[model samples]
Target: MRNTPLIEAFKENEQDLIRFLIVRLKSAFAAQDLAQELYLRVCGLDESFAVRNGRAYLFRMASNLAIDHLRREARQAELRDELQTFFGDEAEVATPEEALISRNELERLERAMAELPPLSRRIFYLSRFEQKSQREIAALVGLSPTAVFKHLRRVIDYLAAVRDT
Candidate 1:
């Protein structure tokens, strides 16, 4: 009934609440974050607010917060599906022949990459997959910036030739 005592109890039981939330939510990070949010929500309650059992009330609040998180995630997944459907061609499912062609193209690209010198292959991966800038690639590979540019250009040209064939 007393606000100060209730707030103290909430703080004292913080770990227990987080453990409960983790079990319900199945994510330690989310449980910790939501537990902090639950504390803030409880603290924001009116001082005159009364509950018969403060711990039970806190548990109920935590449960509601976890449920809300799950609901939000579900809604977001639904929205993603709807957007993909609306976008049509960009998200369209590929036909069997198209899939085969795409797979073959990827295999050809992989073979072309394997044909490059080891350093050139590493630089290409760092630039394309890891998305490092040319300057960063040069620093990592201990190459001059111009040399890195040349290596990348060579790789591109080689891939273009492979695609043409």
Candidate 2:
């Protein structure tokens, strides 16, 4: 095992690093992941590189990672809010005819979903409304991930055909 000064220091303060990250991120799991990332980063540094203070360097790296994670989370939250506002606000500006058409289309889609096999419908609901990953849906439904994908695909194709008609 190659032990650079930074890597050795990182190993020594690993638990403290995780605690610092957990304080910043408020997620022990995220803190663990960030700590792992920090270790990988330090390991990739040149062995010849000299650090006046290895612990400070590691803490700085961890802090930067936590800040980046928080910024990314904030950006995603903003995007979700934007999407909700865009979709929710659109209804207010819709003309009566457009609203009626949307309503009828929704009803048609519901009926088409109802016509689907129970498994397929359940898969579609889980994938879309519940925002579950295919692997997660597979686990819940006692099917392979590929089977879950196929079920979702069938539902999408059926809905597309209905929309086209």
Candidate 1 steric clashes: 0
lDDT of 2: 0.90
TM-score of each: 0.50, 0.53
Clash totals in order: 0, 0
Give the Cα error of residue 149 in candidate 1, in Å. 63
User: What is the alpha-carbon lDDT for the whole of candidate 1?
Assistant: 0.87
Model 2 worst lDDT run, 10 consecutive residues: 85-94
lDDT of 2 by residue, 97-147 (tens): 999999999999989999999999999988876567799899999999999
The most accurate candidate by lDDT is 2
Instruction: Indicate the residue-level lDDT of 11 in model 2.
Output: 85
User: Cα RMSD to native, each candidate?
Assistant: 15.1, 12.1
TM-score of 1: 0.50
